[model samples]
Target: MLAESRFVDLLAQVLPPLEFKLYHLKTHLKKCRKLVFTSKSDKSVDAYATHFFVLSLDGIDLLGLEVYIYESREYTTMFVSKADTTGHYPSDKPPTQMGKVVQQLLRGLIRYYLPLDKPVRVCLFAKAERQYLFLGSAKNPLKHVLSDAQLVKWWASCLDGLKSEFSSIKKCALQIPGASEAAVKSYLPSNPQLPWTVGDIFWEGAPDDPTIAVKRIPRFPDDPKLRFLEFLVAEKRVKKVSRAQFWIELQSRQEFRLGTTVGIFGLEGTVDKHESLEGNHSITQKEARLLREVTLEGDYSTKSSAEYSSNEFASRVPSYAEIDVKGTLTTPVVKRTVETPQVNVLSAGLVRKKQKTQR
Candidate 1:
């Protein structure tokens, strides 16, 4: 994980989670380079992956002209093409605003990579935003401040290092817009769909599946214990809560799975069929809330916190599954099924402690 100040940490926390199918990042970068170099076909960019777009608001006088607007974790590199230039404008000198904004955008790109995760490649799509056009770098010319070739090279180098360190990228798409906003406005929503953009990254007439439209949520190998917890949640042996009911705290013991139920001081039921303490029963909403509260509150004490920290943690957390019944694709009825790995959480911890002591 990157060591960031509270402000940056808050930014990371507030940003929505980005999910991509495994290898989507590597492939996207290659495809983006291809589309830009080839200028051949329209492409569909996965929504889950990060991306960029350029909006030529030249037609809109107040907006003036700007390039390189948005960027995210999966979508890092963007370049305005001379082919998309308009009215024989001096494409070589990017607007001053372009450099300032793009420099900030570059900061974002560097931030995404600093964590040393995978490098993400995104496609460009143009629509509705009106701007002048020119073809080829030499004909229209990107400002020397951040040339198209420079970005390409930077992205290529970043990709080189990232592929060696992590996974391969996926694909890139470019959606070029027509010369006029009136010509393309009908295709796009009145409001912006994404928080960021980098020169119309998607091509026109791309398929829109909205769901599964982007890359798939990243997956890690499952923990056999988490599979069991999912089963318990599904079987209605436990309940879930929407908000914190009380002050709670959680402590992780090597990510081991445990079945727990709890009772608030004033909950309805007092005893179970076996006559165990009300809080200990594997039944009732109170018990579920108690368990979830413990788990969520417990997150603070652990050395690992962010979802991106480690694949091992990601795999294990789900074992104590607690998700809404309605929103999930799998209903409550889906039985948790998996063979538990022989690895013992206790043994893993002891080994880690021993290694630390030796160090």
Candidate 2:
């Protein structure tokens, strides 16, 4: 049994360890340019593996690999591998220093892997927002990078470098709005070929899908106005509406207006009294009072009075003492009195006594 195991030992000596095999693979990857990896399920390849692969190829010191296997809600097991703490940073350097170093490494990987001939799209998963931002040649790449302060400056610098490198490549799409027809035509291919516009050149789609529409703005010398192309390159159904039509539709929609009584949808002339559709009368008097209070006393009093009035006013029915019609407050009603008539009883009694005496 010992003699038989000796052959197995010899075979082990001939073969390299898994880590060493991976390291050798990394070397081969460096020699080859432009390697693209897609996930089995059409999602982006595991970011951890992609990072590790890039780091290894760049000849970064990788100490150990830690694999974590987790079970999802569907009872499916998924595994992820990360660089062990010992391998990720120098022993003497503090953990805080790792951030800059890691960022530099990522930048280096981007520079190395960025496609020279074609525009590259990158999907960045923002852990803070719990959202994925798709970045590419068509969209404003800098906007997404500037989203977080911690990474903004770093990404901006990286993007600057990328822009400089990509500047030499003439095949890129132009993002400037007022590009001439000749310039646009020269940069783009014929209609038979897939239409390539300045917008299409830079547009980066979501991670799962890498397709974008070629956006063209027709600019004729006779008609210097910019006209947007009506259709998407990928989806045939989505069409752009004319600006006039869009404005018309927008104005027609009540919800788009500021308010029923305030924008284009509002009453044309000055209104004497306005009643809400819900059968509730407008609280113009209260509003005017609050406004007056705010203007005279400032915010502190306004807030306190508002709170007090709100609490007090809710339970109380409105009185005719102050009535607001078309922003004017009517004067309070005045009380009036009526008098009763009186007669002289003494004169009447004398007349009756004289008549009795004569009788």
TM-score of each: 0.18, 0.22
Location of the lowest summed lDDT over 10 successive residues in candidate 1: 344-353
Q: Summarize candidate 2's per-residue lDDT along 104-205 as a digit string, tens digits.
A: 333333333332333333212111111111101012111111112223222222223333322332222322123343543443224312222322222134
Model 2 stretches with alpha carbons more than 4 Å out: 1-92, 95-99, 106-116, 119-154, 161-359
**lDDT (Cα, tens digit) per residue for candidate 1, span 1-359:** 32112113322221212211110001011111111211135344321112221212211110011122122334333322111112221222222222222233333333332223323332221111122221121221121222322333322222222222223323321111111333223222234222222222222223342322012111111222223334434855323311111011111222221321110000001111111112111123333223222222322111222122223222332222211111112222222112211110000000111111000
- How far residue 4's Cα lies from its native spot in candidate 1, in Å, is 10
Q: Pick the candidate with the highest TM-score.
A: 2
The TM-score, computed over Cα atoms with residue i paired to residue i, of candidate 1 is 0.18
Clashing pairs in 2: 137-202, 138-202, 138-203
Q: What is candidate 1's CA lDDT for residue 253?
A: 20
lDDT of 2: 0.22
Each model's lDDT: 0.21, 0.22
